[model samples]
Target: LKDALIGMDLVIIPAGVPHKHGLTKDDLFNINVGIVKTLCEAIAKCCPKAIVNVLSNPVNSTVLITAEVFKRVGTYDPKRLLGVTMLDVVRANMFVAEVLGVDLRYVDVPIIGGHVGITILPLLSQIKPPCSFTLKRSEYPSSTILTS
Candidate 1:
């Protein structure tokens, strides 16, 4: 794998057990952490300067773990390490847009923080065409109502 990744410009690490196994992203802490650690080690050895974008389960925790591994190996670079949560952002955008009755394509929501159900922080405050959220008749509440 080192030879295959050699000279790579960007490495996206989304390696881990998927949801079909009844595992939440956070449930991956034990195995995925080590998986990421090993991969990042290889990346450091083969392409130390390459930008590493982590898209694995438990992204929040995995990202932090990646940083730590890189740091330990003296190859840590914040700018080169990224946690890709675009799927989370897209989910929030589509969900929010559905509530707003807007076209999903035009909707943009910035989902930040952890990727788990409770920890996922979808910031509507930064949404474009700034919109507000109204409560659904359902018991589950939108975290916050953002209006523009």
Candidate 2:
């Protein structure tokens, strides 16, 4: 791992146990956190100057954990660490396009906050080419607002 990360300019980590049916993000914490910690430690030692984009599950927590690991190694740099939440943005765009009967490319949704259930808030009011739609509860029964 150290050899692989040597002189790296950017490291995008998507390492973790994938989510499955009936599995919550919290359920992945134990397994994924360790994986993130181990990888962050290696990155800190091998490529401390590299920009790290974390794509692991439980990103809200994993990002924090990554920061802590870097801090422990005396290599923490806030500007250099990022949590990837693009999946949330993409999902919002697709759903909005579906509801509006518009081309997906024309829809733009900006999702903010942490990448997790409820925490993943889409700023519907800020959508470009603004439009509105009423969602009937029966038509969208699932509570999952975001999926990757």
Candidate 3:
């Protein structure tokens, strides 16, 4: 890890088992959490100023854990830490665009909350063309706001 990270400007950690093969994000808490923590520790020691982008599962939880690890090493900077969920954003945009029958490029969605299926928040409230959509509640469900 040290050798790979030397002089690196950005460190993106998508380290974790995925929800494939029925392995849910929660199922990876033990191993993935430790991997994330250890990597963050090394990053704090080796490259204290690098931007750490964590693209792990259970983002809401892993992010907090990563922050805690950084704080423990006295290198905690909210600005330097980021959670990468581009896939989530893409998924939401595509889904919403399909629902609205518009070009996917024209659909913009802001997904918040957690990283799991139920925890994802799709901010559909503010969508393009100022349309209205009813949403069922779920765990940390995503909300989408249209920007058209």
Candidate 4:
């Protein structure tokens, strides 16, 4: 790992199990946290200066965990460490485009809140194309509310 990471300017650690059906959040967190921790430890030791993008599952949690790990080894840099949420953002964009019958390239819905059920929220009020999302539109299957 050290040799592979030498002279690296950026490191994206996406090592983790994919979210599977029937797996509890706790189970996913436990398994993926360990994987992220190991990779982070290696990065901290081998390429401390590299910008680290944590893309593991439960990223909202694993990214926080990574900060602690880097801090433990004296390599924490808040500016250089980031949790990748582009997947959720893209999903929100695509979903919104498909529902509004707009071109996918023109959709720009920023996703707020966490990535899990009951926590995910699309800021419809802030839609880039200025699309409105009223309760009446919520009747459509594609426009189903992500949260109550």
Candidate 5:
């Protein structure tokens, strides 16, 4: 692992137990956290300067675990550790495009916050091409009602 990582500029950590039927994100934490800890240990030893993009499930927690591991090894760089939330953005783009009857390529929606269920927030007001959608109060809760 050390030999292969030498001089690498980017290391994307997507290793985790596969999400399947009956398995919640929380269910994955135990397995994925161990995997992330082991991999991060190798990364710290081999390429401490590499940019680490973690795509592991339960990312909100795994990211912190990675940071703790790095800090313990004296290689923590907050700026270099990133928790990828691109999946949420992609889903928002697809859903918005479907609703607006536009090509997916033309749709752009910025999804902020963590990558989990309610934590994934689509910035509807900032959507490209300027569109609006009506939602029932019961169906779509107000942003103020949702918590991280």
Candidate 6:
């Protein structure tokens, strides 16, 4: 890892294994934390300034773990350590584009709060191209919200 990380300006770590049967969410968090810690230590030693983009699952928590690791090594930079946990946003864009019959590239949907299917509130009112639609509560899950 050391040799490969030399002079790296950016590092995308898709660490940790998939959720398995019988393993709890807490268990997964612990396992992924350990993996991220080891990788962060290596980054601190090998390429302290490299921007680390964490792609691990349970990303919201893993991102905090990465911040702690970097803090310990005195290399913590909030801006440099990012969690690439935007799958929900991607899906949102896709669906919006499909419904609007526009190019996906032109669709931009901003989600707030929790992740998709969790508690995220997609600001559909702010979606690009600004299509008008009536969003009834029954149309989407309770987790999603619509605002004028």
* Model 1 ranges off by over 4 Å: 24-27, 136-148
Candidate 3 similarity to native, TM-score:
0.79
Model number with the top TM-score: 4
Most accurate candidate by lDDT: 2
Candidate 2 lDDT, 41-91, residue by residue in tens = 999989999999998878888999999999998999999999987788888
How far in Å is the alpha carbon of 135 misplaced in model 4? 0.3
**lDDT by residue (tens digit), candidate 1, 4-56:** 78999899998976665776545657778888889998998898889999998
Ranking by TM-score: 4, 2, 5, 1, 3, 6
| Candidate structures ordered by lDDT, highest first | 2, 4, 5, 6, 1, 3
What is candidate 5's lDDT per residue for 10-58, written digit by digit as tens?
9999999977888765677888999999999999999999999999877
Q: Report the Cα lDDT for residue 49, model 2.
A: 98
Model 1, CA-based lDDT: 0.77
Tens-digit per-residue lDDT, 17-55, candidate 6: 877999987898899889988998999889999999998
- TM-score per model over all chains: 0.81, 0.87, 0.79, 0.88, 0.85, 0.76
Q: List candidate 3 segments past 4 Å from native.
A: 134-148
Q: Give lDDT per model, in order.
A: 0.77, 0.84, 0.76, 0.83, 0.81, 0.79
Report the lDDT tens digits of candidate 3 across residue range 14-54. 98776567665456787789889889888988888899999
Query: Which residues of candidate 6, in runs, are more than 4 Å off?
Result: 20-23, 97-106, 116-118, 141-148
Question: Over the full model, what C-alpha lDDT does candidate 3 score relative to the true structure?
Answer: 0.76
